[model samples]
Target: MSPASSDAQWYEAKVPPPLLGLAGLFLQHRLAPAGGGSWPRRAAGLGLSGGAVALMGSAAGTFRRRGTTVDPLHPDRAEQLVTDGPFARTRNPMYLGMAAVLAAHAVARGGVLTWLPVAGFVAAIDRIQVPPEERALHRVFGQDYADYTRTVRRWV
Candidate 1:
């Protein structure tokens, strides 16, 4: 489905972070797994599963330092606006969480069916939610945001 019609209204958010978030999700489910069945599919599942585990570490670190919030687009209101932990690497750990969740689900299911959740995650985060958030962060942090931007990669 087009992200425009999705619940997140991602096009409305108009944020680049969310788009990248969803792309990562899609890559995990749609492209990570290859073939229609068994061996090849299982290999993809292992790769995504491993990636998900790593994301989990990053997610935990982010929450520990920044205080995990359900909202992805309003992190400037974050308890600490952490520059350390996972925030040191990505501006949006929540999106990473969402992507990790999708990957885990695909790994658990082990088939083309896994692709659906990944696509949904991308649509939800990228098109539906993140744009307005980045703007809010920029408004709140200003040049600090610029400095943070210069320091970190959007995603790893």
Candidate 2:
């Protein structure tokens, strides 16, 4: 669907991404066999997952502190154009964090099929959620948003 289209489906515009990531994690565990990996690999996976969580928390906290809306469904309610902290690195740190959590699960699980969920979550968010978010931010912030987009990658 087009980013500015108001006729977007519920899954495209309403479903929270954390739920999708959780479903993806559930599917990965249900579909893939538990993988065997070295302790270091597992530790790295744990660290990645923790870091992802931290990134998301930081992003949310930044929004809250800046008095901006954290609800992705209501981008127009944002009071400020957040560009510091995690936003400085990537435009969608929260979404990236969700994807990273899935990737961490896949890494720890050690199965090729596990990665499928990660890819799926990324694709769904990128295609369905990010477009509208970007459009709204650009509409609200105009040239400032455009400049930020030029400097920050959407998903890094």
Query: What is the per-residue lDDT of model 2 for residues 53-107, given as tens digits with 9 covering 90 to 100?
Result: 9999999999999999998887866779999999999999999999999998888
Query: Evaluated with TM-score, which candidate comes out highest?
Result: 2
Q: Candidates' TM-scores?
A: 0.56, 0.88
Compute the lDDT for candidate 1: 0.60
Superposed Cα RMSD, model 2: 2.8
Best by lDDT: 2
Model 1 per-residue lDDT tens digits across residues 1-156: 733234235433655554665565555456544543466655776676677667656766667655645355445455555567667778766567557656665664465666666676666666556565666566666888779878886655
- Model 1 residue 58 CA deviation in Å: 5.7
- Which stretch of 10 consecutive residues in model 2 shows the poorest summed lDDT? 4-13
